[model samples]
Target: MGIIQNIKKNIIAKAMDKRKAANPFNPEYSDNFQLPPDAAEDQNNSHYFSVHDLKSRQSLYMRLALRGGSAPTEVWFVYRDGDGTVYMNERDHISKGESIPAAVECVEGGKKLRFTYTGPVKKGRLTDKGYVPDGNSGDTMVELDGNFSGLTDTFEFSRHMATEPVARALSREKFTKEFRAALSEHHQVHYEQSGTVTGSLKLGNREIVFDKLPAFRDHSYGKRDWNYFDRYVWLVGLLENGDFIHNSLIRYPAVTEIQAGFYKTGGKTLCVKNCTSMDELPVTGGVPEKFSYTVAYEDGSVRRVSCSLDFTVPFVFGGGTYFVNEGVSDFTVDGIKGRGITEFAFNADSSRWTRK
Candidate 1:
């Protein structure tokens, strides 16, 4: 089974990197910068902005999208980390038309991205307030607008490389002492808990799907040892399809709160997590820059699986673009349909592609 789950994830990633170096946020996170300026080549094809600021500047942003030039279109991807912190992924309408996603033809570019729709929906708020030299370090904020309206179309395309360049922007005691010395050398090792992902997406008019647990390497973020990693989870994402996030590590003081669940299947693939309401994960129409989503997972028994998406691209940064309410997601959970998509990528952190 994948080499005994990579030898039990290298013995639990070395005992969670030594309990993340005795907690207390690992001496401010440790520094290791160097590797920023390299990938660039998007004159104006709509949107694509890969970014990274390791060595403790603590940054990692990404965006990608594709929409109907023809054949199985719609894709989106977004990943954020340098303080602003956001994470979005999408895939829209493509079950039988499957084609356009060789990573969006590995992006050579023809160019097509303008933005400006204003039909309604646009709002933001997320604060567990915990970072930047304060007393907390959970940080989050998302909102976007630049202005366009007239409406043009080429479908959209992106990969990110407008010339790398963004080495270090830290200072909050150098990104909390280099993210607590890199989580105390990544928690001494010993990791486990693998499996969970669902799918269903098609965004031109709108289609959605989700199953949760995208980034799970073991118990913390995946849940098991008093779960909910340090709290700071928020929700309101809607591009068209896909929304079921969970990136692990919690237990020490506990702080995880971006809870979600709205994806159903009778074939034994369900996710319902303590609900209050998101209308079960709906997402209305009229929004499409290009998006898709498909995720599946089952850890209660044997093993079930699903994850099929093309792409949905979107990006800008700081000033705001991140990815939110692109199509006005409605919401669902028991019937299996949580949705959103616009541009997203996952190969296990491609280093925030500057194109490289």
Candidate 2:
């Protein structure tokens, strides 16, 4: 039996090698290879961004979601421009016993959106395998980014509220019952909420709609703590000139960990595995500041992108802190400027970026 098992293993290995040789870059075989989940990098983190064109200029919003334990965490981004500075903020709240859900209504471009929380926070720890746990801490804040004709605003809303009374009754027990649902059914560790978010944005001649399922990951490393990496990533849906920005780095426990990338147009996304070439920003102390990034696709197309600073976005935690300079982000997809702006907004607690 031992000999037979060994022979089987050899055959499987040979088959895999043959497949790799046939197509070295098979999307099916390219498992989006990431660092080990249990490694320090995978414990707790987050990333998100949005772009808007208001009046004649452009406005942008972006947020970096990090893990926190002692209390609800938060951070904000401010961009300084001619007409003053724009801001982006984030926060996360977690409660153990009860699931708190609420109804959220916001007006964007004269349209109203109603959304509810479907479940409670479940996983809340950082592992070495790159998977960070999140909680159902009952949503308590609703923040908005982009152009709204006035200063940005945040609302006090339940994290996991029910749309109907029947749903409401279930939400009362959601925290205790379904507190550990998978962030998303997909293996990517994203998030999925049966609850819905509806919102809209008007970009010049185009009107954009938004629907989001908020996922929060808070893993902390103290002076003597060790288990995972402290890195975060954010992905957003693209409309018009919209693109996805991926940013990650080690904050608490150990410093000098950064990985960032941008996915633009309608092609493949590019990533910088190590932060060796990334130019750090002085505003955020040590965080990656304004740098030029380019994404090359398989179809012979190239896009150039850059992020400028207007403010020092702040994120204070148990181990360290992070700051993002929010301002004019010029993204040149195929060499066209005027991509849009990036704003970073947060709730009162400054735990997570409140977006759909």
Candidate 3:
């Protein structure tokens, strides 16, 4: 049985390698890929965003099914105060192609956490330039009812369009179109931003109010396949000096190459830039004790940051483990010092691949 299982694993790995070779990571791909009207209308395409508040020591995660009716939308609410106690809850509902409307009525509740979309999704103006989410007034309004109460002061990042002539031309090719369409059946375009959370949270029946808490939110739209990457690391930080940073590193087994996430930084709200490197301590039991990395913009400027774990909670889905860690970190940008919350996620699967 062991020999047979090993053979099966070897075959799967070889097939994955071939696929990765065919879909090599092109740094400029996203910069060049164009979404056709039909592609943009794909019901399978979806959007997801999450917010983490360090001051309040809580986080709210949400995902919307933009067009698809096959599955339900999900929300995850988490809270971790200084007392070492943690609270979390997950909720899901079938929208049946009424995502925009359903969002206004969606609700998830538990003893420690509860959330609801209290209002309509202020639709952003669609332009030939691209979709611009209406400011906080135009964005979706969500009411967190359980551990925390208050509205999220969310912000949207600038969109990066495909500019290379070659990429643009290839994007219109039959193969490219078909490939993207197929991938969309499982993936979507991802966008994110940072924000401030205002409201109060309950600590063992005691109500604590926060005037302003540092927060971060992200949104992705399209078909999403969580298993696309063998593993990945996502770290987000919001500093005391009103700065925010996000770093992600994804490993695709097919290409044996690592696709780094766009490193972003700025005051309260940050913009996305290219990342150079990500270094971290060895992971044990699916958690990394510490991490450090650097990000560079198009102008050749760079920034460095480091973080150490404070606590972590494990979330499992689709037979995979995601360890979300909250940590303390220091950011040095242009000789300035700032501190904030740093979080990391690691996806682990011991049997996915076999070593020779």
Which candidate achieves the best TM-score against the true structure?
Answer: 3
**Which regions of candidate 2 fall more than 4 Å away from where they truly are?**
1-51, 54-262, 267-276, 279-290, 294-302, 319-328, 338-356
Per-residue lDDT tens digits of candidate 1, residues 235-289? 2221112323221111122111122222222323233223221112222221333
TM-score of 1: 0.22
Which runs of model 1 end up more than 4 angstroms from their true locations? Answer: 2-5, 24-313, 316-332, 336-356
TM-score of each model, in listed order: 0.22, 0.37, 0.54
lDDT string, candidate 2, 264-338, tens digits = 334433433332222232212322335554544334455555554322334444334333223344344344444
Error of 3 at 180 (Å): 6.2
Preferred candidate (lDDT higher): 2 or 3 = 3
* C-alpha lDDT (0 to 100) for residue 215 of candidate 3: 50
> Candidate 1: what lDDT?
0.24
Highest lDDT scorer: 3
Ranking by TM-score: 3, 2, 1
Off by over 4 Å in 3: 1-73, 90-158, 161-187, 202-204, 253-285, 320-348, 351-356
lDDT of 3 by residue, 1-356 (tens): 25554454455445445654575443233222333445432333333334455444444444444333344444344444444344443233334444432232212210012223433223233233322334544233334432222222223211232112112222232334555554335544554444444555443435645454555545444544445544556666655565655565544333222323333444222323445432343444444545556665444567776554544444443344433333433445445544444444444664432211
True lDDT of residue 348, candidate 2:
26
